[model samples]
Target: MLELTNVSSGYGETQVLYDLSVTAKAGRVLAVLGRNGAGKSTTLKTVMGLLPTRSGAISFDGATLPGKPYEVAKAGIGYVPETRDIFPSLTVRENLDLAAKRFEGSDWTIERVVELFPRLGERMSNGGTQLSGGEQQMLAIARALLMNPRLLILDEPTEGLAPVIVQQIHDKLMELKRGGLSMVLVEQNFGFATSLADDVAIVSKGQIVWTGSPAEIRADIEAQHRWLGV
Candidate 1:
């Protein structure tokens, strides 16, 4: 459903991606893994057009994603950055309403989002700043779901949350995976990545150093450590 070919990009003068190539199939999850500073987040940002690419191409659902963030979002891609981009003052309902504004097809709705994360329903009118960390995360996911994205790009969805909340988030990911939602997940947590990823790509120094199934990755622990410092 998505493909990146030798994508090289950077923030201004310093390049962060070096000829990185990766692919994500529909109804599957591609777990992007690496140690910090391995350019994993940069890969997602570039793909989402949050950062400009100096070379190569990014295509989603058979068309190119131009180097523009709004255009990319409008082209049926939803991005939940590592920061989880939630508005502190916006109510839960307000947040979902904002994301739903640009949606134009049959994929997601506020009701579906609330169902996916029932907690959001209970706090529909609560401001983002009033939510717990886990609730905030759910709000972020709900906001993205309301966008009706064909492909969801999540950067560290489970970062810094409690273990139960992490498990909850994982369950949501697995649910989405079963529903055939194509996803690209960047995670530093190996256990979390292996549990949900259909494919794994170990990135290193701005390039994909290994691409294989999770089982294949386990069989080559030495390489995993070398590339991902696992």
Candidate 2:
């Protein structure tokens, strides 16, 4: 459903991605795994048009993606950054309100997302800053769902959270996957990622070094040590 071919992008003269290529197929989850500074997040940013595609192409659902982030979102792609970029001053409901978009046949709604995330339902009136790390992460994902995206790109959904909270996030993502939501996940939690991903792409130095089924990646200890340092 989403393809980035030979894409290169960076911030002002310091190139981070080099001829990188990856694909997230329809109704499947693609996990991009890499160590820090390996340009994993850069790949997502380029695809989302947050960073200019310095070279190569990105296509979504058979069409070239627009050159703006908002356009990309409107094109049915949702991004939940690792930073959990919620408006600290806004109430939980207010944050979700900003991202709500409705169209014919849309499956996601504020009421539905709140159902998926019961914690969010209880904290609708709480300010963004008042939530815990896990709650903030839940709020971020809930807000993205409010957009009714066809493809969701999540950067480190489990980062900096307690193990129990990580499990909650993983369970919720599994529900989304079962619902046929195409996703591109960049995460450091290997077990959590591999459990949910159908395909895995290991990135090194800004380029994809290996692509395989999650089962293949899990059993290849040498590849894990060499590419992922696992």
Maximum-TM-score candidate: 2
Alpha-carbon TM-score of each model against the true structure? 0.97, 0.97
**lDDT (C-alpha) at residue 176 in model 2:** 98
In terms of lDDT, model 1 sits at: 0.89
lDDT (CA) per prediction: 0.89, 0.92
* lDDT, candidate 2, 1-230, per-residue tens: 89899999999999999999888999999999988999999898888888999999999999999989889988999999999999999999998887774433467888889999999989999999999999999999988888889999999999999999999999999999999999999999999999999999999999999999999999999899998889
Best by lDDT: 2
Per-prediction backbone clash count: 0, 0
**Model 2 weakest 10-residue run by lDDT:** 98-107
- Model 2 regions lying over 4 Å from their true place: 101-105
